[model samples]
Target: MNKQLIFFFLFVLFIIYSFSVYFSGTTYDKGISHFTTEAKLGKKLFQEKNCISCHQIYGLGGYMGPELTNIISYRDNDESIARAFLKGGTAKMPNFQLNDEEIDALISYLKYIDKAGNYPPKAYEITPYGTVNEIVTDEK
Candidate 1:
């Protein structure tokens, strides 16, 4: 009798664990799709704002700051991203003074660029801000 009870408990736990895994994976795919849309919007903004004139993504555009294709992998957090964008960099890269919306849009475009494999291999990792910093080590 004890054996049966233990087996039943294990079965129940297994079912719960499987369900959680399935649900989490489903949510992840949906989230990636949604973010992909924002990334597309970002791509458009990147071009329109003349960002490409200075920065290049995936073998295109001018040379300014480093290529942003894999920015997600480099920085630890979005605060870093926001800071860099708002303050710009040393004498060479001037701050564009982009508003919140513009910054968000630009980030999205960088997402698109990153997706295109523009940065060093294995650069992006999935972060908490709507999914960044996700690195596919096996994407080859």
Candidate 2:
């Protein structure tokens, strides 16, 4: 009887856990699919150029370049700063010799990505349960 009761309790806990997990929803942005025409072109260009080899987004790409996830916001939303870099290139960065239209498209894509999220999250707490909880705010 005790074994049966324990099994029944475990079954109830499993059902509750499954329901909670199903209703929690996803943390990803739903608007990610809605990119502008220019941004879409930029995404294609980004893949074609293999920019991930030198740069990272959300800390998932190469470490040779700085993470670009929040670069637009970090640069005070100055598209010109990024434009100049792409136009002339830096000492560490090679000049891709991209035309004006290509550069603009890339900038637009970066702007769209910037709106997605931040890297190295602003605030996070490490729980005693060995889980990290991100504290989201409306600062942006």
Candidate 3:
């Protein structure tokens, strides 16, 4: 009887865990759904251009260029500057020869990325093992 009760309890716990894991939807769905049509095209262009080779999104790309996660907000939402830069590359940056529409699309994508989240997160804690953990807060 004792063994049977233990098995029944374990089975119940397993079912509850499985149900929760399957039903608890992810948080990313909201962010992903916010992507505009232009932003989607820009995302495709970004991947095609291999921009990650030089630029980073969330500090995960090469160090050749600055992180661009919050560029739209950092630049005070100045699309003109970004457009000009895309139109003509700087001394170190190469011009991709993107047209006005492409530039607009890219800007839209950047805007989406900016709204998604912040990089170098506002808060973090260093673990005893020397690894850093991002601290999440209720912003909304």
lDDT of each: 0.63, 0.84, 0.82
Per-candidate clashes come to 12, 0, 0
Better of 1 and 3 by lDDT: 3
Query: How do the residues 1-140 of candidate 2 rate in per-residue lDDT, one tens digit apiece?
Result: 59999999999999999988877765445337537899999999999988899999878998888899878878788888888988998998889999999998999889878777577658888999999987865333
Candidate with best TM-score: 2
> What lDDT, from 0 to 1, does candidate 3 have?
0.82
Per-model TM against the reference: 0.52, 0.66, 0.65
Off by over 4 Å in 3: 1-30, 123-140
Off by over 4 Å in 2: 1-34, 124-140
In model 3, how large is the Cα lDDT of residue 121?
56
lDDT of 3 at 55: 92
RMSD of each: 9.7, 5.4, 5.2
35 in model 3: Cα distance from truth in Å?
0.7
What tens-digit string does per-residue lDDT give for candidate 3 at 16-130? 9988887775543535654899999999999999888999997789778788887877787787877887899898778999998999899999888877868765888999999
Instruction: Tally clashes: model 3.
Output: 0
At residue 88, what lDDT does model 3 achieve? 98
